[model samples]
Target: MSKVLIIFIKNPVAGKVKTRLAATVGDTTAVEVYKNLLHHTQNITHLMAADKFLFYADFLQREDEWPNEQFIKHLQKGNDLGKRMHHALEQVFLNKYKNVLIIGSDCFELTAAIIEEAYLVLEDKNIVIGPAKNDGCYLLGMKNPQPCLFKNVSWSTSQVLQQTISICTREHLNDCLLPTLTDIDDENDLSVEQKIYFKLKKSAQ
Candidate 1:
């Protein structure tokens, strides 16, 4: 029974990674913030007992903190967010991973425990989603590949979580919901106790 974790991320370029955050803080600050998020995610996921795959949003980084021995890197395919996610999961399922989980690099509250829990929930539930406190979701997992959950849903909108739930209900898929967590999308999201932390830290640096 092979389990796999797929991480979706963009290259941590100055003006590319977190556009909304960049809008609030300058581009350099946004880059620094994104790098911190990446480092945090990498540290947590590195300890998980599963095959890890890093799907870059655009190009692949051959020389980075993600040591080549630990992660199998690839470029993300498809035309939109939904299709790209579906494709990544689909490829892993095709590669024979029974338990598959996919996550983005935006959620500050994501922990190794939550990821481990997702793997466990997939033991019975057909799907598990870690909903963001805002309009989107942070993590999505499946016992087996079900690309239907990624379809017919709006991307980058406040209604994403609701729309995904509707699709799950319509498809009759048994879904488990994890505790909602804060995802860093805009200034308002960081204001949840993290704005001060990030700002002060940036000031010192």
Candidate 2:
């Protein structure tokens, strides 16, 4: 089956990305952290078997770290997070892809293996979700477009996963749950290695 991996990312701009993490670490540091996360995401998805799509939040970037030759790029549509995600899925499904998965650039622990598992599980399931430990889901996949899953969700809140699950149950969609992972949102979520890296980054600045 043909599969597509949709990556949603914001253009790394100081004071714009990672606002919650920026509350503790300065804006510059937050941008730096976001850039690192972007690199990590690029590393994991660049070589994956599925057709990759890079969905930017604001505008299309013609030239950047993400090799244009490998990824099909587009701008994310709609106003809120849920609407944007739903729109992305709608677009991909319209293109006749058999399986589609969407991920954001916040989860450092999200690996290519996990992403592959998501696509693999869709072979028999209607949907797959990778829950972020607290904030929300890091990854979501489906074989067909399910608009209900994205509606009525409070984005960026702890209730996001539960709300999505409830929707799945209500819609009777057979869904598979992936391993819970961490999303780098709060200052407390930083790992020891990340802390050291940030410290050194500051020292070098």
Task: State which candidate has the highest TM-score.
Answer: 2
Which candidate gets the maximum lDDT versus the true structure?
2
lDDT of 1 by residue, 63-145 (tens): 99998999999999999889999989888888878879999998778999999999989999998999998869899988877
By summed lDDT, which 10 consecutive residues of candidate 1 come out lowest? 188-197
Q: Which portions of model 1 show Cα errors greater than 4 Å?
A: 191-193
lDDT of 2 by residue, 91-198 (tens): 888889978999999989999999999988999999999999894999999988899887889987899999999999999999999999999997888899998899
Candidate 2 RMSD to the real structure: 0.9
- How many Å off is the CA of 143 in candidate 1? 1.6
Name model 2 segments beyond 4 Å from true: none
Each model's TM-score, in the order given? Answer: 0.94, 0.98
* Model 2 worst lDDT run, 10 consecutive residues: 148-157
